[model samples]
Target: MTTIGIDDMALATAHHVVDLADLAAAAGVDPAKYRVGLGQDRFAFPAPDEDVVTMGAAAALPIVERHGAAGIRTLLFATESGVDQSKSAGLFVHGLLGLPPQMRVVELKQACYGGTAALQAAIGIVSRNPSERVLVVASDVARYELDSPGEPTQGAGAVAMLVAADPRLVEIEPVSGLSSAHVDDFWRPNDSSTAVVDGALSMSAYLSALTSAWDDFAAHGGAGIDEIDRFAFHQPFTKMARKALRRLATHTGAALDDVLQEATFAYNRELGNTYAASLYAGIAALLDGDDDLADRRIGLFSYGSGAVGELFTGVVRPGYDRVLRPGAVPDALAARVPLGLAEYRALHAVQHPSDVDLTTPSVTKAPFRFAGLRGRARQYERTA
Candidate 1:
């Protein structure tokens, strides 16, 4: 059997921080709406120099180090925050990770579903050419600008998945997916700093996509909503995901019992939404929870815009615990230095220096930093 698995995984985030309580006050909303209602606590605060590339590389480094450079034949970087319009982020990541040269490097986009799409592509490459293994990295810095409705929900982080045959993580199950062209749910204009989202409409669109994907998957003999061992979704926000859950459970009569919605949201609640990294984060949360998922399968629904969606499944591999980050995620979430409103505002106002000298002082000990810009090219340095 052609089995593909995750060899390792990693994650990283910004140093400075914004506590949700203060962010809620600034947005003129209740803190619980985000902290409790949305299931968030902190939103990672990125420096002017760092973006998705740096964060993405940081998350993958720990895993790449564990697996080494020999077997990797493909490097895929998935992100909505593309640093360059023409260039692939994978090239930079390849250099950052010190991988072998004989590999395919590419970048993919499909909203939050980018990483999952990359993962699917990697699986195909491995299944067809058994000698090859693929590295799928997802990273993003979610920013909604100051004072926008999405400001309080913004977050930054990355996750890396090492996919290879006869794997140790989980096997990707075949499932069908559905997509819709909803102009209002989410979008980022060329010149816009903040993403535009129609909250109510986007919530509606997510459920609609879920319905269609579930129907198609079920028709293909895939697991129905009730049969899924765990449901991992894109963490747009606790409230938004909850709305989709209500719709899903109501439609299928299945209850949400995997991870406590509060605890699941807590992971993202403190970190905010990682854009393309959100769904993978959800998967990590479910795996880390106390659910009886052994011999069971997980269903993943990925959605992104400009609009695309996919329903996929994976089985939890034995010894998955050994490869997990092991309290690293929770530790990272807890180590955040909550910033006062004034500090957050000032930090947010700072922009990336035109000629930043990357070899500067270490602002945070998070193992990731923006080294500098060379020939107008951004550089990311991994300290740990």
Candidate 2:
């Protein structure tokens, strides 16, 4: 059987970034509390003309431009920060990419796990139809009430992947370890703009889910505790991922050493939490930080609050280094302009404007951007 996996991948984050130290100063808290305790350097947020749709499109447009839209038959958009309840978010991206009209597009929701769900589904689709290629895009804008416990973790970003046979990047194994249960560790009500979180409860639940998923994976012929060379995890906060690895080591009694790299999550610490795109963005950061990963086994863990968890494995393809675009993440990060506390507060309010007629001249510099709301219908445009 031919192998199937990620062929090409790309990532996009908000155009504006706010330094955590600035936020800490405004809150009258020690900057170290957020920088060290949370292991976050900065938090990302969209510009006035940006959102999940625009960010998602920006990440995916490169793939379509390179691979063309010929064999692409379906698009799976995974997002918790959906702009609409009824329509699929991928449709807007499909239009932006100018893909063929006869295509399948749908939005997935399961908190952060929605991205992993979309990936698994895409792999299954390719198995049934080898000729078809699937576009998987995970995008989100995590929000929290001002000064709330979850506010420091707020972020926005997206990841786009091209999944097909004989991929140039990595080949995903079919097996996965999964754990799901009804839990209210974190939740967002339909009427509210921000999420409600039980911080301590969430941490405890996360540890439990990690061990359960690892055990199931071991039982299902997955790699042993320390067998995989590198690991990528869904990080709501960078420090939580560190907590997970330590817990996994204790659970399996394995001395899983030297599998992590400073580069693996360097960008993530700056991004805070991107919800659905967190794990994939970590993978990009890992690849961006290192080369020489050919034929190396990698472990991936996905978790979503409300909540679902999965542990899967993929092996780096031969000559994977040559195809990867290094410095992409760093380049994007360097391009962003910093937002002052007052500017951030103003933009946050503008994002949730009460008026629907938000039509105005587009000010965003991204390739794709939200062109404000026209009679409650969200409009988008291409700037370049």
Best by TM-score: 2
Task: Give lDDT tens digits, candidate 2, residues 303-337.
Answer: 99877999999998887888788778788888888
- Which 10-residue window of candidate 1 scores lowest in summed lDDT? 257-266
**Model 1 misplacement above 4 A:** 255-263, 352-362, 382-384
**Whole-model Cα lDDT per candidate?**
0.75, 0.87
- Can you give the lDDT of residue 200 in candidate 2? 93
lDDT of candidate 1 at residue 132, scale 0 to 100 = 76
Evaluate model 1: give its TM-score. 0.91
Steric clash count of candidate 2:
0
lDDT of 1 by residue, 1-384 (tens): 777766567767776678878877777888777766666777887765467877787788878777777778889999888877788987888887788888889999877878888888888888888777788999887777788667878888888888888777677775656665755688878666568877777766777888777777777888766667666777887666676667667777777655234434556766788878888887777667634556567777787765667777888887777666668888876776667889878877765544554444456665666676676677777767
Clashing pairs in 2: none
lDDT, model 1: 0.75
